[model samples]
Target: MRILALDAATEGCSAALIGPDLALSRFEVAPRRHADLLLPMAEELLAEAGWSLHDLDALAFGRGPGAFTGLRIAAGLIQGLALGADLSVVGISDLAALAAGARRSAGVNRCLVVNDARMQEVYWAAYDFDDRDEPRCLGEEQVAPPAAVVAPAGEWYPAGNGWMAYPEALATVHAAANGPVAAIHPHALDIARLAASRVARGDAGSAADAIPVYVRDQVARKSA
Candidate 1:
């Protein structure tokens, strides 16, 4: 089964294709350019695999609790591509993607995924693989001050920009945790991998049903 996935949920813009034998991807940390860069990156990756949107069995995207604009951009693109291609789509969590990334890169079994959400808060979640070996969220993903973030007891490898943005605060909260792999950002490669698992279980939804998850409802703060 071939799957195409894209993510623009943070400073990064990334696209990936998982073909029968090989995986191809494009990833870059280009903040203001996700809107301009995502589609071209998707096209290039598809072209490299000698495929098109029609050839994909499913399309997937990050459904997020990160930048509101970035989440919308990715969801909009995924919706269009899936609609045009008449393909099913899956929405993978950016938090879950971060967890998967930590497992792949550092063999971390427990992960605390946090992305700086501006306004002195973060989008954070904790994850550990289940007996089925799929990453399972420990609790609801949330947006809160680093100090208010609750983690499951035991060790966790910290991942994402939040760790870098407020290291002292996060460290105070998760001192028992081993890392600050702050360089990691949600990537479509991991999104694709997670989506592939969902697809195998017949869990993909229709293109028209795709929706972005912005945990923070209001895009702008009211004057205080």
Candidate 2:
């Protein structure tokens, strides 16, 4: 099945398509530029693949716990595309996508992701790759101060910028890692892969379900 996915939940923004010919992707670390870049990236991928939004079997986006604006941008775009095309959509977790990248790039089984959430807070989650190579979140995703982040005991690989964003606060958390990889962000490619799985399993949602997931809901709640 053809799947198109986009991510703008961090400084990094990416768009990816996985289907027929070959996988195509565009990514850049352009903070505050997601609004400008993400759409063009998606259009380019679809154009290069000679497909339109309607040709896609499913649409996917990083439903997030990262930049509030970035999350909204992606969700709004996904909703428009899905609704216009009358297609189903999937909301993949940025934290889960980060963990999937860790497994794909480094073969790490366990992952702990803590992305900067601003205001001295972070979006954190733990995951383990099962034998099927699918990432399963160890617990619910959360947003909290770095020192308040709790991870299950294991040599989980440290992923995301929170490790660098609040080094002193996260030192103990970092010390429990199997090894440190450079700070990383979620990618649309991984999001597509995860979305494909969900779509195949009949778990894809309607266009109206394309909504941003702000783990720390008070701010979003107030705005809503």
Candidate 3:
């Protein structure tokens, strides 16, 4: 199966292509240039893979609990690509993607995913990987002040910028737990892998169903 995935739910923007034997990707940390970089990055990945948008069987993207603008940028691109290609779409949670990234990088089974939500808050979620290497959300996704966010009891590796943003919360959680933190970003590669699993399970949805999952919409405002 050929799948294309993109993520712009934070300071970083990335696009990736997953083919039968190989995966190609493009990533950049362009905080204010997501709109400008995402498509071009997608184009580059597709070009490198020698495939067009229509060649993809499905489209996947970071749905959110992230930057409002970044979430919209990714959602809009996924909608356009899926609609134009007549392909199924899957919206992967940004927090889940972060957890998957940590799992992929650190080879850990459990993770605490958090992204800086601005406004002195964060987008947080806890996940544990199943035997098939898919992240299962352990709790509800939320946007809240770091102090109020509680980690699931037990041993788990912490990940994402939220830990860095709220070191105290991370410390409090890890001090009582068994494992340490593993800092990582949600990469497009992880999104593609998760999307592939969704597609295989017949979980892809229509383009109209491709919606951003913004936990805190009001936090995303145009600055004067």
Clash-forming residue pairs, model 2: none
Q: State the displacement of the C-alpha of residue 106, model 2, in Å, after optimal TM-score superposition.
A: 1.0
Candidate 3 error regions (>4 Å): 177-180, 217-224
Considering summed lDDT, which 10 consecutive residues are worst modelled in model 3?
174-183
TM-scores of all candidate predictions against the true structure: 0.96, 0.94, 0.93
Model 2: how far is 122 from its true place, Å?
Answer: 0.9
Q: After superposition, how far is residue 121 of candidate 2 from its true place, in Å?
A: 0.9
Per residue, candidate 2 scores C-alpha lDDT tens digits across 1-224 of: 79999999999999999996679999999999999999999999989999998888999999997898999999999999888889999999999999998888888878899899987799998998876688899988999899998867867788898888899999886877888863499999999999998999999999899989898877843333
Separate clash counts for every candidate: 0, 0, 0
Q: Relative to the unseen true structure, what is the Cα RMSD of model 2?
A: 2.5
The stretch of ten residues in a row with the least summed lDDT in candidate 1 is 174-183
lDDT accuracy of residue 180 in candidate 3: 57
Error of 3 at 79 (Å): 1.2
Which residue runs of candidate 2 sit more than 4 Å off their true CA positions? 220-224
- Candidate 2: deviation at residue 149, Å? 2.0
Error of 2 at 152 (Å): 2.6
Name the better of 1 and 2 by TM-score. Answer: 1
Write out the backbone clash pairs for model 1: none
CA RMSD for every model?
1.3, 2.5, 2.3
